[model samples]
Target: MKVDPDFLDTLRLGGEFNARQCINCGTCTALCPLGMEIMPRKLFRYALLGNKEAVLKSTEPIYSCLLCKMCEANCPGGVHIAENVRALRSYLNAEVLEV
Candidate 1:
């Protein structure tokens, strides 16, 4: 699967979304306040799989994030939930039409 250079750069800059460490443990989802509705854990899985469509479709949940930093705090792998979310938001903003 070809990865998006911009997305990869975002991950690097965000200092999270550790593509190497994620084991699909669902910890991020369990800890996420939006999990009941958004399901970040599943989103992360889609991202790791390089499913850009799924990732983009999931952007609403990513943007809905309150940036509370709670998910990152509880992440055993230390994923930067807020930063990654912000990066995804930025990517979505640039890719989608405002209308």
Candidate 2:
């Protein structure tokens, strides 16, 4: 997938999203009761690496985030995983989904 790494920074700079601080600890994915196949960690990496195709293809898991903040609470990096997931969903809404 084509990656535009700067897009991640744009997300943070353009919005209040804060996924850059993620430490890839997988706490979010672990606490996700849905047992999503790809989420939290992968999505964050895709976003950070600017993998637009992968990121867009991951719409389901992105939208699947329950906003429970379980991962955020356990995060040692203090990454707002839930908020970042919401931001990704919002970006998808405005750019890809356009809804």
Q: TM-scores, in order shown?
A: 0.71, 0.85
- Candidate 1: give the clashing pairs: none
Name the best candidate (by TM-score).
Answer: 2
lDDT of each: 0.65, 0.78
Instruction: Tell me, by lDDT, which candidate is best.
Output: 2
Those runs of model 2 whose alpha carbons end farther than 4 Å from true positions after fitting are none
| Candidate 2 lDDT, 23-46, residue by residue in tens | 777776787788885768887887
